[model samples]
Target chain A: MAQRTLLNQLIEALRCLPGVGPKSAQRIAFHLLERDREGGSRLARVMAEAMTRIGRCRRCRTLSEHELCGLCANPNRDPGLLCVVEQPSEIVAIEQATDYRGQYFVLGGRLSPLDGIGPEDLGLGLLEERLREGLVSEVILAISPTVEGSVTAQYIAECAAQGNVKVTRIAHGVPLGGELEYVDGGTLALAFTGRRAL
Target chain B: MAQRTLLNQLIEALRCLPGVGPKSAQRIAFHLLERDREGGSRLARVMAEAMTRIGRCRRCRTLSEHELCGLCANPNRDPGLLCVVEQPSEIVAIEQATDYRGQYFVLGGRLSPLDGIGPEDLGLGLLEERLREGLVSEVILAISPTVEGSVTAQYIAECAAQGNVKVTRIAHGVPLGGELEYVDGGTLALAFTGRRAL
Candidate 1:
C-alpha cells in the first residue's frame, strides 16, 4: 500500500531528534496518527509559542518566558550565592535534590576547544558582567566532572577571582550509597584526596 | 519557576507514544520549540487530517484513506490470492519486500484466548464471508509463528478444508544468511518438521 502523504511528512519531521532513527520516526508518526491528536496539536502550539516567547535570561542565560527565569525572579533565593550548571536539565536535577537555595547560572555548555566551543558560545561575557555587579559573593561550580567541565570551571573561577568573588567547585567523592568496590579508580582517588577529618 | 501552561500541556500531550517516557517527551517538545515550528505544525495538521480520513477498508480490513486500500484498489494485484497478516504494519513490511503481489486481509490481531481475544475479535466472520465468494483460489497465512498464530492458522485451515479453496501458510525456516546456532529452538523445530524431500 502507498504511504499517506501526510503520514510520510510527519515521519520525516520527527527524524530531527538526536537519537531518533527512521524506523522510530515512522513508529512515532503512526502512533500520533492512531492516537494523541489533541496532544499533537497542543505540542505544535506550545512549540511555536516557546520558540517565539522564550529567551535566555539577561543575568543567568537560562531559558525564560519572561525577562528572567523563575529562579532569578524569586525574592527568597540568596542573591549572593550562585550555582553554575551546564544546561537547563541540570537545574531540574539540582532542584530535585532540594539542598541548595541559591540562584543558578546556566552556561549552556562546557568549554570544548577541539569542537571550537569557547567562552563566547557559552555566554561567559554575560557571566563576567553579572559578577561585576558585585551582588554574587560565592560562585559554586556544579558542572559535570569531565575534563571539559573542569576547564570551563577553572576559566569561570579565574574570571570570578578578578571580581574578588570566592569560587568553589562542588565536592567530588563517592556518591551517596555507592559501594567502594564499584567506584572507579579516578573517582576513588578523588574521594581519597578530598577526604575530611572525622 | 512555574512551568508555562502551554509548555506543560505540550509535554503532557507528547507522552502518548509506546516507549516515550516523560523526560524524553519533554526533550522532544523542547526540540520542536528550539527548531521546526513549521515542521511541527505540519505534523500536527497531518496527524489530525490522517486520523479523520484514514479508516479500515471495507473489503480487506487494511488501513485505507479511501473506500479500499492501495493493494485492494490496484488492478494488477491478484484478487483471488489473499495474504492474511496480524497487523497493518506487516502489510507495510511485505510491500517493502516486494515479494508478494497479491491483495491482503488484515486480521487486526491474532486469536489469543488467554487475553480474551477470539475469532470474533479478529473479524473471522468477514474472512469466512470473503472465502465463500468462490473467486478466491489461495489464502496465504502470513501471521507470526507464535502459539496464538498457530491457533489462528489451524482455525483458518479448518475453514478452508470445508470450502473448495486451498489454504497455505508461509514457511517457517532459517532465514537467508541466518546461522543455525542463532536460530531459536521453536523456529529450528518448525524448520526441521517442515523439511521437504529434495
Candidate 2:
C-alpha cells in the first residue's frame, strides 16, 4: 500500500513535534524532500545525537551531555546564589533575559501529587544536600505562580531555612507594557500588591 | 559557551522546518527530549531514511522508494484514466477526498517561465510520451486556476490532442461549502459560466 511508503512514515513521524499536526507534518515532509533535503538530513543527525547523548546534569538536574552542566562546572559563576526553576528550558529563558550569573537547579516539574509527582521524583534529596553544603547564601524561586508551584516553593524554602540560607521568590504581577485595563483581575491585584516605593 | 550545547544545536536544527521559529523550535526540542524520546528517535531514523532513499517514481514522478510508486504498481487501478496534479502532496489530498482509482502524473510545479520553470522542467516530455502510447483514454487536469496553472493545463491539453485522448479539467467555481456572498468575484463569474444543467 502507498500508505506504508517511507514518505508516509516520515510524515507520520514528524507529527511527534510539539505543534505539528497531520497536515503540517505532510507539508514538512514534502517541503524537505522537494526543497531542503540538506536541512532535513542535518536535523536528523543532530536530533539523533541529542536524543541518545543528552542526560540530566548530576549536579543541577538540567539536560546535559556531561556529569555537570556548563553552568555548574564553570567556577566563574557564583556558587553562593542559587536560582531554582521548574524546567531546563526556563534556565535558557532566564539566561537570555537576565544578567544573573548564579548557578541553577532544575526541578523538572512542580509538586503534582495527583499526577504522582513528588519531591523524590524532583530529586529534592539532592537539593537538600546542596543546601546543607553551606555554599549558597540565598535561594531564588523562579517557579510559576500556581497552587502546586507555591507548594513546591514553600517546601524548598523550608529546606533553605534548615541550612540558614535566605529564600526569595521572583515577583508576580501584570507584565510590563501591558495595559492595566486589559490586565486580568488576578494579575492586576498582584501588581497593586507588588507596587514599589519608586 | 552553553550556547553551543547539544540541546541548543537540536533547537537550531529544528528551525529548518517550514513554520517553526526560535521559540517553537526550543519548545519542540525540549518536549521531545523530556517526554517523547522514543518518538524523537523514531522520527530521526525515518526522516534520515526518507531523505536519502525516497526518490521519484519512474512511472509517475511521485515520491517512492522503489522504481514505481505503489499506485503505479497496483494492477487494480485503471491506467486509462490519468489525473495530473501540480505536486505529490496533492495526490494524497485527491486520494483521501475521492475514490478515483486511476493512475496519476505529477507536474511537480506549474509552468512559470520567469521562475525558470517550463514544460521540460515539469517532465512534460515524459507525459507526452505516455499520451502518445494511447493507453490513456482520458486526461484530467487537477491543477489550480492560477495564470501559470492555466497555461500548464492548456499545454497538457494540446499534448493530449495530438494523441486524440479526451481532455477534461476540474471545474473552478465557488467551493463546496462556500457562501455565495463571500465568494470572490472571479470565482462567482466562473461558477456562472461553468453552470451545470442540474
Choose the strongest candidate by lDDT.
2
Q: Candidate 1 docking category?
A: acceptable
How big is the positional error of residue B70 in model 2, measured in Å on the Cα after superposition? Answer: 0.6
TM-score of each: 0.80, 0.96
Candidate 2 structure quality by residue, lDDT tens digits, A1-198: 557889989989998988789999999999999999999999999999999999999999999988888999999999999999999999989999999999999999999999999899988999999999999999999998889998999999999998899999999998889998999998888788888898
Error of 1 at B95 (Å): 2.4
lDDT tens readout by residue for model 1, A1-198: 566545566677677654788889877766655556556655555555665666777878876777777889889999999999988767877888878999999898899989999999998998999899999999999988889998999999999999999999889999999999999989999899889999
lDDT of 2 by residue, B1-198 (tens): 367899989999999999889999999999999999999999999999999999999989998999999999999999899999999999999999998998999989999999999888999999999998889999999999889999999999999998999999998999989999999998999899999997
lDDT of 1: 0.80
Model 2 segments more than 4 A misplaced: A192-198
TM-score of chain B of each: 0.93, 0.97
Judging by DockQ against the true structure, name the best candidate: 2
| Candidates' C-alpha lDDT | 0.80, 0.93
Lowest-scoring 10 consecutive residues by lDDT in candidate 2 chain A?
A1-10
